[model samples]
Target: MSNYSRFSRRRFLTTAAASGIGAVFLKGCLGNPPEPVGTAVTEQVEAAEISPEMMPETTKVVLGYIPIVEAAPLIVAKEKGFFAKYGMTDVEISKQANWASARDNVTIGSEGGGIDGGQWQMPMPHLISEGIITNGNKVPMYLLAQLITQGNGIAIAGKNQGKGLGLDISNAAEFVKNYAKTEGRKFKAAHTFPNVNQDFWIRYWFAAGGVDPDKDIDLLAVPPPETVQGMRNGTMDAFSTGDPWPYRIIAEDIGFMAALTAEIWKFHPEEYLAIRADWVDKNPKATKALLKGLMEAQQWIDGVNNTEAVVSIVAGRNYFNVPEDILVPPYKGDYKMGDGKAEIKDKMMGPLYWKDGIGNVSYPYKSHDLWFLTESMRWGFHKDAISDIDTAKQIIDRVNREDLWKEAATEAGFTADIPASTSRGVEKFFDGKTFDPQNPEAYLNSLEIKNV
Candidate 1:
């Protein structure tokens, strides 16, 4: 049964009464002032009773989401009452139409009756901070928390599954590179966004194999949900994106799993919980409360035992809307790559919400942001992507909310999991490349292929 099953029959009746499902059963008119029916009773809360520390400075918080499982922490918190527990009584987890829309909406904010914050791409906060995404009319955004890391899967053509391939993508890229040069046809790979982490994974995959992602093959920015069909229709030779899509490729035998992104760069921080900086500054307590609830929801999701229920919740109409079967395999650590190579999911692929979860992920890790900034530069995604490591750190620090994460985590008693240092310390990519946060310039110079 779902968490909603635990609600009492009386509570259900009251909710149903308001919703017009049970007008016959309701003793009074739907609009009539009601008494408390149960815990939380109706949506309204008593402002006098709410301690200032416990309440958001403003009760109305509109959080936008993309309906992917990367949104688990946010969705789970709202569904499980973590938001309410933190005294953010009026919360809206609005479904987003696309990444561009989510960014634009959150950038504008509830002042325009738009979203105040949301599950935005990781690079966005930095971009926003630099006034890149917003241009001169910048709306400063902050990374409140990271959502999920390494929940993405890479799928290659079934024909090329084991054709000169080891576990790494080097072999595939080599084949594609040679094919592209001789045939003048570049293999196309679809990702959700350019300059976003998904595109980073795609570029990194090809480049690891000595194929220039910028020149050798076409990288198309297709929506995540459309990737499977894009592959099926031969629009792309391979596709990479968040879970369920790659799982769809695997189950349907259309393509083979190349590597989970985490395999490429273990627990590469992806999606984030971000909000307008003004919102954070205005509602410090509410911000902490948001983190507190999400932290708890993440803990709940970290348990593999909860995978099915987690899938059920996320796969419903309001979320991923993908079938539960498609969602189950990846969540349960099973992978049947279309190439007849089946491997259990790598827990390190995190499939992770917490930095301590399933071998983990990170937040406002200045080094992590440094890497993202470098990747964006590599692709020429940001016209003026910062090349200076020191300046990058300053920019990241300006937008990052590690202090907020610390306050919430410590108050929630998760201090034990906090790392002694903010940096995950020089990350190693699957291509055998190391990124030293101290020397981002050297790291960028080491790359053999880059648009920049």
Candidate 2:
């Protein structure tokens, strides 16, 4: 007998009414809500056809996620029954306090009251695998898939508005470079974490305009909420982070967006879905099941008419815990860039999951991993671990699990969506710099400002 079978209808109703959850109890008793139109029915059919042998090795796993737009697919998979559809009924999507807490938790593993794995910043899995960020305690992780593209940017405090702090800070590079001489301190900036995606974005923006990130400004790792408060108090000059934190900056009148990551590098890789390698090796079938659920959730979020539903689910109290209105604009690609800048209203310039301008957003491309490591080398981050291009390639080969993504895609009947190669080919940035996976050295040498 099931757990629900132990509850008599009369007793259940009485208890629910006493707790003021009568409506919720009735809804649960009626079964799941009706599926949406289009692909949902087909997805239901596919899930219904999953045989006994195809079931996952385990039904329970704890996953951690920060409350950013990048974590939408993980949240959607849990809320929309995607995980359950794949035989992962007890999957838990735990909310992480911040990136630091996430790192600390994953270091302990789920059995120790930490998470198995979930969303992560670029190259974190690789860094963790090599023990670069974990203080020499290597926690080998697999880069399962890319969670999102774009939906991030650099936000400037209101006081610095109209100081040429826009996307191209070339005209105002000297003003930023000379802050210490004039203001008696270096211009302050912050990112959510150090030497990762957010840090790289702000650093790239500064370096592109001839401002040395190391010498021209003071960049540090600060949490989003604290960063916002600092901006309001005129202590933080700028910050790099993902939505809806950046969106909140504009909504609350604290600052204006300097540049969207979309403009910096269109359809650039953002966060990812990665898991501990030990957990994955112990439960291979369960890993694939998790991928299939995430793939379905990604497709569901990419639907043209499902933006409102996406916002409603992710912005709930259990997830992002933010207002739906704040998330809606970015989902629609309707950015109201303040500081007298023109608005960006293109749908393609927002957060994308399954696919983007270059194609196959979910596929964990090895070339992308190489770029992150290469960027790390450029900044001399973890110089001893990621020594050179060859070392970076070796790390990419060891950590990037594109083969797993392919297998899961085939099992999920999404083979057609898979890319022909691991490399996305040559990538172009807004500053007219190109990174060809074939020759990363050339790209690094072409840069005007770099540590290496």
Candidate 3:
């Protein structure tokens, strides 16, 4: 039996009509004028009081999702009703056409059921803050929660068959040393959004290897779904995107694994569920409830036994729409190119689970934002950029909603004291270096590839 099974409309009417005073109280709760006299006033009042907590029933939230395996937690959340356990009854996951539509549906959608929020790629939060997306509206948003730390890998066309550039070699740096190299010499790279995680990762990776990505590579904005085809047609040289695309490319022998973004900044931050800053401010309670449900959903998706179950549900005809084989392929780092002679091993694919996974979901630490911001400037977003401290604080204050996150954390049974200031906890990047937000200039100066 379900909780709603005993949630009778008649019982509610009985309570609402117990007295004239009770009727008035119910009316106040309902916030409306009386309906037609023939229609039961008490019944209308009860129907109007149907909040998820009040009914312990359906709580539907519309989410914007791209048809990819990274959306598995959302799929599991919907199918297993993890959301319901958190006082959310109905949760709707809508497959979006692409990252742009997914983003716009939230920032620009009218009341008729747009995305409440969904998985947003990194650097996007910065792009959004910089007013780079559709409408140019500086609709500042908050990352109330994270979905995964990292789920992207770089791939190179296997047909090139030259072992391409190696991560360990300095010679690889010259592949795209100048924009002219890709002119009639087009060395294509694909990203879902021009300023998204794929773009940021590729740019930073090349920069770390001593190459200026913006001036060297001919970047093509292709959907993740088309990345493999783009590579196969020789329209792209390499691309960095979230899974199934990387795995699918390897499985088809069209591309070889270049490197994982996590390798760049191990356990690097990836995707998050961001909300408009005004929305978080106006509806703190609703925002908390939504994050609580998402936290529950993430936990469910990361449970050991639930991996197969998640893959099965997300790959359904209406979800990711990919075959099961491609959906649940082993993530233990075995790269299979066409010749069956090349193999790379590493711990790769992961769904967000707070404090549990290798790259656990955490508050968008300020250092992470700084790293991306520096990269953005290195590639050019801020001209004569402000002090790293001021910019980082501004971005952290605007892009991460700590108050709302702490509220949701309390409801979700997490007890850590949410930091009261913009200061991020200690951060360690891949080169065995640490960044202290309290003093960021020294850290920025230490990086091998600081912005111009």
lDDT of 3 by residue, 11-62 (tens): 5444323221111101211122111011112112213222344343224455
Candidate 1's TM-score reads 0.84
- Per-residue lDDT of 282 in model 1: 90
Instruction: Give the per-residue Cα lDDT of candidate 1 at 4.
Output: 31
Expressed as tens digits, the lDDT of each residue in 244-282 for candidate 2 is 987889999999999999999999999999999999998
Runs in model 2 with CA error above 4 Å?
Answer: 1-46
Maximum-TM-score candidate: 2
Could you tally the backbone clashes for each prediction? 0, 0, 5
Candidate 3: segments with Cα more than 4 A from true spot: 1-60, 110-113, 175-184, 330-352, 356-362, 382-388, 416-435, 447-451
Per-residue lDDT of 1-452 in model 1, one digit per residue for the tens? 43332323343233322311111111222132111111122232111123434555664577877656788888776665556665555566766666766666666677765678888776877776676766555788888788888778678766555664435655466678776675457787887766777778877877877778778777888765576665666656778777877777777877778777767877678888889999889989888878887887788788768887777767765556678998877766666665656676665554777754323353557667778887877767766547555666777888888888888778767887776677878788777789998777778899988877
Residue 226 accuracy (lDDT) in model 1? 72
Candidate 2: 10-residue stretch with minimal lDDT: 19-28
Candidate 1: which stretches are off by over 4 Å? 1-54, 159-162, 165-167, 180-184, 355-362
Flag clash pairs in model 2. none
Prediction 2 TM-score vs. true: 0.90
